[model samples]
Target: MSTIRDIVILCNNRMAFPAIQTLHSLGRLHSIGVPVENEDVKAFCAVFASDTGINLIIIEKSKLKFQLQEITAIKDLKFIFTMTFPWKIPEELIRQHPNLFYNFHYGLLPEMRGADPVFQSIKKQKNETGISVHAIEKEIDKGKIILRKTLPLHTDFTHGMLCTHLSYLASYILPEVLTLLHRNDEGMHQDETVAEYYKKPTIADVSIQWEHQDSKSIQALVNACNPWNKGAYTHWNGLNVRIVEVSQTDTLSADQHAPGTILEINENKGLIIQCYNNTQLRINTVYTDEGFMSGHKLLAFGIKNGEQFATL
Candidate 1:
């Protein structure tokens, strides 16, 4: 008879909540916990406060080693699944656990490996991205792949949208991955040749570069930053203007205008901004000093058709 594995899950973000609940419902999870220092972790724990069957422990990142040592003394923990866990596990602990440590990275392994893969994927205009379940190693996302599930990326998917979709996909495939691990499958090795890593997007990375980027690229940046990082930003008339949502327009202007110039403004058509490569982008939504407003409302804030957005 096959032995049942005792598994502990460490998660911080809401994306992993569905998967945690699934494992708990199946009676496959030993415990689910998060680092106590993070507010997001606390918020997630609050959602399950009434559940008597599931135990949620909040341990400090610094104390996790000792906590794990104590838990290992009482129970035979065969695996640790990390989902959006903030801190990096020590190499010594991983060495002790051997093949028992695994991480669910919300990106295709060997590429788009980093803090915010969904955002990076969107900004890069990738048509498809995926979730990678892999062995945890000292190097971030350099681990061998145990399982990977691809997700199609639509042009309109924002950071939050893509992440939510990937989270659902992760939960759906987790059971099969656990089954494979229980069967003593080591999974497949990742190719190092094609591996690429992306850093988390900073304010500068998301800042709209109207002079350098075409309409499609700018729209991608806006989509990548939405509902999480907020949106790609630019200064307009000394006020911080966040381009929350934009769309590539089919309209073309024969008039030569500098990039970032407001070519047209109409309530029905939105704010049309000239971009590189003779393309124009219609601003659908924006956030200004006043508050979030539609593109047509920019006129009320003193935004004129002849003015240009300043580059940061």
Candidate 2:
């Protein structure tokens, strides 16, 4: 039987809540670390600490060095786990406590090793995505892998939906991961050949590229940006709009109808728009200054079937 003890978790969001709960139940949690700026996590940690009598460490970025040093002094400290910690752990800390740190990445390692991999995975239309448990190295997400748990990436899955699934996945696999670490498993090095790194997306990255992208591609982009960004945005008739819900249609458009051109507006079908390769998409929901509205409601705003969405 493997015994796990005295683990600390550093996290920035609700995604780590399940993991924290699991550790607390197992009596292996030592304390929780939260960024001073993240109010929600700090508050959650405060309440949890009050109820469970566990320590809550506030991580001020400027004073992280001293705070981290203090944490290490706590008796019987064993392992440290981080999930979307917002900042990199100092190299000196990892060197001092060799193999003491592990991070849960929301996407598969090597293939998706960068910020916001959840959003990027969906935007890229990946057929599958996963969570990776790896040793924390000096570089971002460059650590050797301990294990990975994957789930099918459904076409209808939104960024928020995938995030929730990955969070639960992390909790579900924590015990096995801890057992592996306890047995002196150093894990395998990541293959650099297939590795990729993507930076955090800017507003421009979430915008719909109607001209060159096909209907299915556009739908994927929309799903990737849901809730977080409302949806993939575009401008039409001088009004900015976000397509909240969309689905690719089997219908084909005439050559004269360029991509982004509105082909028809059906009460039941919503707005039908031309897409690249003469394909079409049914726009179900949209967000504007008036808030979220059905795509067909654009008719009241003087939008017509022939008008095209602005390319920019």
Candidate 3:
């Protein structure tokens, strides 16, 4: 009979769901929410600590510190973890079981690596986006590549939608990757030349830079961050309405409406604003920090036709 390993999991929701389903079937079960200081995660850990065969500790990378509270007790505990959480791990942890520590990123490494990589790629208007399963280093996501694969994305996909897909990809690829990793004699090395890095998207990144970017780029920018991350921000009659939804228009004529002018307004057509190259932009929706408003409501809010919306 094959050796059945004992496992304890530490992760937040999005990841915890899938990782839980996969591993819980294979070994012992323990689940936790992010605010790791919570009652359930702590109580579960307290019970889990009683077992010696339960050597494996699978946790999201950031929450590794949750393990430290009762440090000396679980000192010899083994782990196979990922780094998507908000906590930190000591060098001693990684050094203890060098190969056991694994990090998963949603990108094709030697290319897209780091936070919001998929969002960054889509915003940059790449033809495709991919996911990478790599080991994590102290320098963050800079580690050896394990498995990399690109997934198809529809042009209409919003950042929220894309994240959902990537979350699925991470969940699906993880168990298989773990299986392969366990059997591997040596891990694969990544090429530094093709390696790309990124940071979390900034407020400036969410806003549209009208002058510097072309229409397609601008549209992609709008598409990439829609429904989340503050949308494609600009100015709407100085009201600071965010673009929540968009679609490139075949009807955008050489006619320039005022920046925030109602160049075109129809329930189906949305509100079109004029731009360079006679291009018109149709903003389907707008969102405030408090709530989201549709283009139709913009008119109700006293946004008149032919009036320009200035960028703030």
Candidate 4:
């Protein structure tokens, strides 16, 4: 068998999502340009920045790392990042050393298979979440498996919280996967039949759809954007209001009032607006081009109880 090369650490945690926690635990790696410092701590882009001979890389983004299958001088002994690694690369970059080695994924390989694995996993409220270390082939997360382990997702875990959990897991799990590679040990191939795909959601995609959705759908929208994009929505009035905090009411009603219409306003309660299907959305926080506006003051500026949102 061939001997191991060097180890690379790729991270894009400027956002410091869950994957960052795990990358922190792995053995140290050399840093150059903006990768760990300048770039997201969870990016595998660091591998080819300077040197190659990288046999391993600890994906830092808590998503997936390394979007490419092959690395010229670097070989990721492992994969870890927020996105998947593509299969092929131009031959010009390849000399003898490879560019990437391996990748780590937040969800089951082939299943829950896409970027924002951690985010998608948590929002779906899966009973369990895990990480995967796989070799970079053409199709992402479709390469030969190197290592994988389970990590539970708690109910209270938000995007931030899930990121923390996965980061910690990367710490403990990476070294173990490396040991396997060192010993020439390869793990199981994924069951392609079970594989499912998810797209990387945009800030606009997760925004509140104040039309005929159910209360549960509203909650999902809120959860999807938490800790990152927050809420994607406009104000109960014409202004844009980023929904920060949300709690569902027990019952659903028919307010006839247009969804996104402000239903109630008070100093203490903030602005309660009619959301999907008569569901009420209590918005405690808002953002204007200027800054933040207190709930009470918003009401004072023509945000009365019965007045339609924009009219007020």
TM-score for each model: 0.94, 0.95, 0.79, 0.67
Predicted candidate 3 versus true structure: per-residue lDDT over 1-312, tens digit per residue: 122443334443353345545555555333322344444544553454444233334444455555643332343333455525545446676665566556666656767766767677788777777677766566666677777778876777777777778777776775667676667624578888887788777778787765555556667787788655657887754577777787667665555454444676657667776655555666777776547877766776667667775554
- Candidate 4 regions with alpha-carbon error over 4 angstroms: 1-5, 14-100, 122-127, 154-156, 235-237, 251-258, 292-297, 306-312
**Residue-level lDDT for 123 in candidate 2:** 92
- The local distance difference test score of each candidate is 0.84, 0.89, 0.61, 0.54
Model 1 residue pairs with clashes: none
Order of the predicted models by lDDT, top scorer first: 2, 1, 3, 4
Give the number of the best model, judged by lDDT: 2
Number of backbone collisions per candidate, in order? 0, 0, 10, 55
How well does candidate 3 match the true structure, expressed as C-alpha RMSD?
4.9
Of 3 and 4, the candidate ahead on TM-score is: 3
Deviation of model 4 at 114, angstroms: 2.7
User: Between candidates 1 and 4, which one is better according to lDDT?
Assistant: 1
Winner by TM-score between candidate 2 and candidate 1: 2
**Per-residue alpha-carbon lDDT of model 2 for 1-312, expressed as tens digits?**
324458899999888988898888888998999999999889988999999998899999999878888887777888889988988889999899888889999999899999899999999999999999999999999998999889899999998898888888888998899889879898999999999999998878888887899888999999999988999889986899999999877766545787899998868768999988788999999999898999999888889878899755
Residue-by-residue lDDT tens digits, candidate 1, 201-246: 7879989998899999998999998987668899887788889999
